[model samples]
Target: MKVYLDNVGERRLIGRADVPSEAGPVWIVRLFGSALIIKEHYTIGTVTHVPDGGARPLMERAVLLARGQPPELLPGWQALAP
Candidate 1:
């Protein structure tokens, strides 16, 4: 899946991480330049531009938590897991 980060003027390709699933399935999305980490749970999403470097981990966790769920869609777009 590809995500566009308009703020950074770049596009991010999202895919599954190439690791064993003893932990569980995970979904990953990456964007270059001015990296900002965002996590969404339920209806609310949060964004963190700090340099703590926790975005990837948080996204993986979100995927695990959302396993077996249907995709989410807004008015004009849909969010599908990869």
Candidate 2:
């Protein structure tokens, strides 16, 4: 599945990764320096910091989280608006 990041102005392709074995579908969102992994219909939102110098991994994690897997926590990646 493809997950799109809404940067307000334009959507960006953050990363692409295979979905988790159990997770059916999910949506992952990253803004500022926080990452949020959400199920398609779930409402609660949790924000966590990404690690330093971890752009690629964070992107991959975002993709995985979008696919319903637990996000791989990276503490310092920043999301810039388009």
Candidate 3:
């Protein structure tokens, strides 16, 4: 799933990471610009953004919606993940 955060002029390309689990799959997100590694651990409900060069982390609470349910977005239209 790709998430476009137009409010901040950023885009993220996400894919499932290789892990064994029945709860929820871990996701690997690549943020545009800068070498920031973002990982979403669904079981913990947290999104961690760690920037390179020893910068501070930017974390946020994330909600995982079920398949076929799209995440809320702003006025601009967004493509629903399939």
Candidate 4:
């Protein structure tokens, strides 16, 4: 899925990820221009642990956005265009 930094003056195209259909809440946290995106993955009949305040981690990706890139978004979450 196409990701973006939404706290800046102009929206910045950060990066993307391959989130599954059963992916739950997508949590993103940023600091000093760096960000960590955590996607909850699960199946229809499967169970998974949630990312708690103090835990190892779940399936996630760390994206470092460029400080000079312009903000843009794709047409859809699973789209390749930007």
Candidate with the greatest lDDT versus the true structure: 3
Error of 3 at 14 (Å): 6.7
- Residue 21 lDDT, candidate 4, scale 0-100: 44
Clashes of each: 0, 6, 0, 2
lDDT of every predicted structure (CA atoms) = 0.29, 0.35, 0.37, 0.36
Per-residue CA lDDT of model 1 for 1-82, tens digit only, reads: 2222222433232332222334233333323454455433221222324347555433322122233232232112234465
lDDT of 4 by residue, 1-82 (tens): 4444534434344555443444445323232343444322211122223577877655433222335333232222332356
Candidate 3 or 2, higher TM-score:
3
Which one wins by lDDT: 1 or 4? 4
Which residue runs does candidate 4 get wrong by more than 4 Å? 8-10, 27-82
Q: What's the CA error at residue 70 for candidate 1, in Å?
A: 2.5
Candidate 3 lDDT score at position 43: 25
Stretches off by above 4 angstroms in model 2 are 20-82
lDDT (Cα, tens digit) per residue for candidate 2, span 1-82? 2233444434444433334424434433443443445223311222234578875333232332233322233223333335
Candidate 4 lands at a TM-score of 0.25
**Ten-residue region with minimum lDDT total, candidate 1:** 39-48
Model 1: pairs clashing at backbone N, Cα or C within 3 Å: none
Model 3 misplaced regions, further than 4 Å: 1-44, 66-77, 80-82
Deviation in Å, model 3, residue 67 alpha carbon:
5.1
Order of models, best TM-score first: 3, 4, 2, 1
Candidate 4: minimum summed lDDT over ten consecutive residues — where? Answer: 39-48
Clashing pairs for predicted structure model 3, backbone only: none
What TM-score would you give candidate 1 relative to the actual structure? 0.20
